[model samples]
Target: MQLEEPQLKPRDYVVVASMLFGLFFGAGNLIFPLHLGQIAGANWLPATLGFLVTAVVLPLLSVLAISATHAEGVYDIGRPLGKWFALTFMVLIHATIGPLFGTPRTATVAFTTGIAPMLPKQWSSAGLLVFSALFFLAAFLLSYKERKITSAIGKVLNPTFLLLLAVVFFVGFLHPFGAPSSAPVTAHYQQAGLLNGFLQGYNTMDALAGLAFGVTVVTAVRGLGLKRDRTVSAVTAKAGVLATAAIGLVYVLLILLGAMSTNYFTASAEGGTAFNQIITYYFGAAGHALLATMLTVTCLTTAVGLVAAFAQDFHKHFPKVSYTAWLAMMSFASFLTANFGLETIIQWSTPMLMFLYPLAMVLIGLSTTSAWFHRAPVVYGFVVAFTVVPALMDMVAAFPAVISKSAVGLAVTHLRDYLPFATVGLGWLVPALIGLALGLTVYAVQQRQHAGAQEME
Candidate 1:
């Protein structure tokens, strides 16, 4: 009995996998690849590969990192860096993924991108209010009990989402819009399809979602009877593999759908438009049958997951507040933000995402390698210190044009232009590498000093 590590049943794995998939595959996930296929056009294959790197692979690694570190959540992920940093980073992360913005954005994205066009023009504002209220209410209900999250999402919600989406995928591919192989390419894609595709994947901000969602998945694993961190991590990794694999498959289908639509429609300004047009073409007047349901399900699943995660983590840290209270607060905050402040929410969020993604990626990378440096604070401090400046610059660059034109923003923007790969959105790469090397050198020197002291004693 001692030899046995408590294990989850195979069914549990599927349910957990479904839950994780539900959390990660939100509205943005749906739209991005479809748009990628349109722009990549004939270059769809390479573009798909690039998209998979960030959207599929990075998210999976995020789960693995948390598991491997045996860390409770994002807070633990940064704990080696000291309490203040870890707390600050965790707050920023949860805030980004929580009610203030990301959570609400999911609701607004579904309504604005999918449902709004179908409504009478005069109903837009009222429509948003009503829709957002209902959306947040449903999300709050689904996430009401933390223990029930896995089953509520995996058994009930996720399968429904897939079934609804599958109807479109089946009919669209079976009849065919046309091969994307010869689709006319966008000019930039013609010049740099692969690179452009990678950047698009980066822009999806799945890396942030990955970091934020880590707590949810970890908690879910613990709820399922795995007591040891090792056992929990293993199960979590298995579930993550299943989840990301499912996500990757879905992305391919959506991208193909976009690519093939070249025969029937020009690429619209955004994936939401492309998706809407394709549904309209496929199902005609009954288009909302698939469109509204599918988009809503995707966004709702994400909202449930994020809200549940926020409540759990906050309750853990701020024990004075009950979990249920946190849940209610998040839902209410999301409700108000979704209806009245969505545009403002998006403007602020883009800059925040621009700032945090590089830092999150660096942290994820460092955590995955935590054992090598023994989870040293110096290593984390150095890497993050170097990455923060460029990430801040990216944040400034992503600000609204009105703000970006200001003197302070212009100065930062001018300085960023001198950083390599800034235009490609990876100006932090080189600096991070330099930090890693210096940190290792310092670490080695410290190790030698400790060894010599021990030897003399």
Candidate 2:
């Protein structure tokens, strides 16, 4: 007789949900929505809805997709794409979320929002360097034990982060700076508010993180004594839903705060700066301390989670290196990158994200719906191939002005003119759909041929 695995209780579910929320919510989460609200102006409602689709809904779906597929990690999620593709995709996702961009970003955001405002002008650069070192050191120590990440973040850091944000939300909302401006919406936001908001939400990069973080979530679920795949997936899905709800609520509140502050403040070029200004406006000197503490804690939790996830995944692939070594190495790299500052990181990352987001979305979409096509490899390959063209176009479009003005950029621009939804950064959607149709048709014909051959033999 087979033994049944135990299920998580309600309280356990809350803990897991909080852990997922902490993992997903970080520096981008803090800055993007606020900026969206400021730019969206009177159209903030529709914009917020659009942002929620990619930021909250897709990320939640990513977690469920991983659960449904029983994927051990992103590599497992991409396995139907073949070994080479799977390995490459997994490496890119991990590196983006780990030391290359996302991890370093957490430290930069913390410094800008928390530490920089308090420092004298001359001291800011040195302060950032020192701050980054300490930040990554703490992250390295915290992430040294992967097994403890869930409890450490979910029970301790998450609640503390929430409490701080709650104070900011309560004070800001209760004492409004000013109503949302009746001023004209930004040029891009005026008409295509939903599309622009959707694109902006991609900056959060949670969907990609979702693929990598799923392993940690699954491991944590099993650690709680749930052994069956069905039970584990069910718990993971429920936890994901709960976490998304929390994240959505926070985003809405932040957007509202941003909208209300629009009249009193001119938008800063950087969202982090605008956010810092909002807190200072309402809470005065004390607000700086509050914002600083909140930013540091939230960024720290996210850094630890990302580093832990990356190290755990890489360690599985290269057991000889050990998890501790990978963790230390990633922490060092992130520290080095963080000193480059937030704006430079964002500029450098945008083009890469333009390419990667669509591919990540396609993989997540296929993983969730794989059962419908009987897990056909051709289906995965075709869709990914079709998606790449538009993704590359988006990368060119997002390239720096100097590059975009070059011969290759001019060629890409002309090509993009013919692609559907190219202007909205969704040129990949049509190709992806067509690829799915062709792949399914080819798969059906091949199956029929194989069946007929077997019968004749």
Candidate 3:
């Protein structure tokens, strides 16, 4: 039987954007930016802007690139670099954002805001474990199928999530705040306000979700009857722009609210704990509870999406497992990890992302420029080689301070002579640039050889 297709028009981009925003804006979207502003204090304005560039702009562009390229997923998007490279990139991204890190984070955040405060001092940790278990069980149930009912529920709840956040921000702002706190004594970093804020924003992992989101956006566009590749690409780009704009606006508001909170509250608490205090101080305990409920609901939707996305990807790669089986496996894994709590989950995720993100960025760059090299394997090989080594070095360096610090200083010092940009956190940049140069040189050589052979023929 032939199923009817959606003939999506330009106007549907709004709906697409709304859906994308709902998918992208999860737990970190709520509190992390707030903490950034509080940390930046009077420097909040510049810091927030810096955060938006990486946190907001990069993810949106990634979505647009996915659509324009007509890739199956992020791995497909990186196919210009060869199939195996794409597969490795996919594994790393999924591990970071899937069962290992981002999935569990949802339950952790939900528990911190929704259940932790209500617990007595001694039983706090136990309460958190119980809440996360229950939360994932609910998410697992919600994601038991890839059906209309679940999608409809998510669409409905997405708006409520936004509304609750808006309420919290407005209420917090209306109450007068005191002067901003001074910077931490140990705070020594570049773009101090901006760079640190940018890295912190990475916790959102929206860029990782760009791959999952591209699939949904493409499906939605096709459902609207825009099945033509070019049209789908254009529509996805438009929708992504709309979604990013909404996210940037919300981030700005949250950061401002966080900065303002410092006037009335101390900066001593963890961002998560301080967040609850800020809301409760403004609108009372009832408001805090309401916002916490909203956060849990939002995380629930995100968890559902992540589960389904991972299942879809895994089923595609390993059809023998079946989608149902894959979903169950991922859900169980996420459920178990959620017990570790949000703080630990986030702490562990950082080094993984630091190592993997450079590789991901290399793929994104190559994919975006695939047209220039005619999707040649030579370019892919050079770029992958250039990126992988530095990334591995980064992972190795991110370990026990005493051992890695002493060992890495000497290793990096010696390695710097041969490795380009070894000093920058972006050690891959110089190598990637060299790869681009070599790729162009090799392409030129190949083109000349072809011309000579043609003349002989």
Query: What RMSD does each model have against the real structure?
Result: 1.6, 1.5, 3.3
Candidate 1, which ten residues in sequence have the lowest lDDT sum?
A: 1-10
Give the clash count for each candidate: 0, 0, 8
Residue 387 lDDT (model 2): 96
- Write one digit per residue (lDDT tens) for candidate 2, span 113-184: 788989998998999999999999998898777778888889999999999888888888888877765633
What are the lDDT figures for the candidates, one per model? 0.86, 0.87, 0.72
Q: How high is the lDDT of residue 208 in model 1? A: 72
Listed in order, each prediction's TM-score against the native is 0.96, 0.97, 0.88
Candidate 3, superposed: residue stretches over 4 Å from native: 1-11, 147-150, 176-186, 189-191, 223-226, 400-424
The true-versus-predicted C-alpha distance at residue 340 of model 1, in Å, is 3.9
Give candidate 2's root-mean-square deviation (CA, Å): 1.5
Least accurate 10 contiguous residues by lDDT in model 3: 181-190
User: How well does candidate 1 match the true structure in TM-score terms?
Assistant: 0.96
Off by over 4 Å in 2: 181-184, 453-457
lDDT of 1: 0.86
